[model samples]
Target: MQDTASQATRKVRAAGLRPTRQRVALAGLLFAKGDRHLSAEELHEEAVDAGVPVSLATVYNTLHQFTEAGMLRILAVEGSKTYFDTNTSDHHHYFIEGENTVVDIPSGPVTVHNLPEPPEGMEIANVDIVVRLRPKRR
Candidate 1:
């Protein structure tokens, strides 16, 4: 079986990003755990816990780079909190309001209709839907 480091290297390179040591390490952390969402602070804490020796600033830069390279999707929640989603496919999400958790909505369940037309000479990009969830009050 391929190790995590080499796999991260390949993944990063495949996404048109140069696999530096720190990038490879961060990529391993981001992709090794399967698809999930995390903020830069969370990832920085994980790096510290894993002894990766990376700064939060570097983590932010790396995540933005990865996002630009289409390796990740960015989700904005709670007005100021941003989470990076590892899954890049076309899908919606469920954001748990108080818990700060993000859950993937199955691909076929949610359907959107009646989108407004874009301005002249502009094309519509993919649509993103974030369904907020909270505990039902009894």
Candidate 2:
């Protein structure tokens, strides 16, 4: 691992993650873009293109573990496969329908005006607000 990513791995290990080679490589790929969203397939393809020496299965497992560890947010796009978001802060996303791309929307002072309350026993784990949008036709 490089010096910069060694520090990153240390931080992730501090958060109770093992920081395995696969996990560290995946983390580096995710953080390399400086805040972006990518699907598992997309990431796997990128890794292969860059010759990162990781398998697709490892990508999926690392994604799941990283998500469970709160390192990334899982974006469940209705009627589509899930996307992994690099931004960890409280925010929403915009799904471009035909593009199959997700974009983060600023959640500043955004409050849910009308929403049903959660069930008595189950607590709110996440609030996924996705805006499916279409490009303006000429």
Candidate 3:
């Protein structure tokens, strides 16, 4: 199996990202944590701690670029923060409400389909589904 660092580089390159030092480094940090959903601020801090020379803005930009290129999935878990996902497969998410965190929910054989067809002209590019859940009130 390929190492996480190598896999991150591969993923960015495969998504048409140049895989520059910054991009690779950022990807490495994100992918190193298995199945993580992190905020830009959190990632920026991690990257900073990892000695990566990327500014918070650059981190945000790279994250947006990765999401746009389908290398990552971005989720809005309320407030003004965005969460980035290393897993870009067709899957759903369960947002841990009060904790303000997200987790991938495997659909098994079932997939999200059967949405009404797109309007005449615009193409159907992608579908993002977020399921929010909070701790049960005792």
Candidate 4:
């Protein structure tokens, strides 16, 4: 328990973010489970259930702060629904449509080709490929 808190504090500080009570608590919940994807609302619910008094807005704010600090990546898999991925490495995902779940695709297996050149004065930052999936119908 104490180790998790300390680890979270160190992580936050390393990202150049202040390790506030809420930030540390949230970070603990986030990274403790290893690499995973979750939405702000889902995290907020976890916080509440864990007895952490926090608002949904704060969760969003902290998540954005982490994203800006490069600790997380924003994943938009579904319409109007955004997920934060703890694994910030370059990789792809498989989004299960009905289950609303995101699963990581192993690196190096998926290849992308034939990307058009960007407009003048603009370079591509990163490419995100989300392959939507559904159960085969009979």
RMSD per prediction, one decimal?
Answer: 1.4, 1.8, 3.1, 0.6
Error of 2 at 113 (Å): 2.2
Instruction: List lDDT for all candidates, in order.
Output: 0.94, 0.84, 0.84, 0.97
| Model 3 C-alpha lDDT per residue in residues 45-96, reported as the tens digit of each score | 9989978889999999999999989878888767677899888777778888
lDDT of 2 at 91: 94
Work out the TM-score per prediction.
Answer: 0.96, 0.89, 0.80, 0.98
How far off is residue 46 in model 2, in Å?
A: 1.4
lDDT of 3: 0.84
**Number of the top candidate by lDDT?**
4
| Cα-lDDT of candidate 1 | 0.94
Worst 10 residues of 4 by lDDT: 105-114
Could you tally the backbone clashes for each prediction?
Answer: 0, 0, 0, 0
Which of candidates 1 and 4 reaches a greater TM-score?
4
Query: Candidates 2 and 4: which is better by lDDT?
Result: 4
Candidate 2 Cα misplacement greater than 4 A, ranges: none
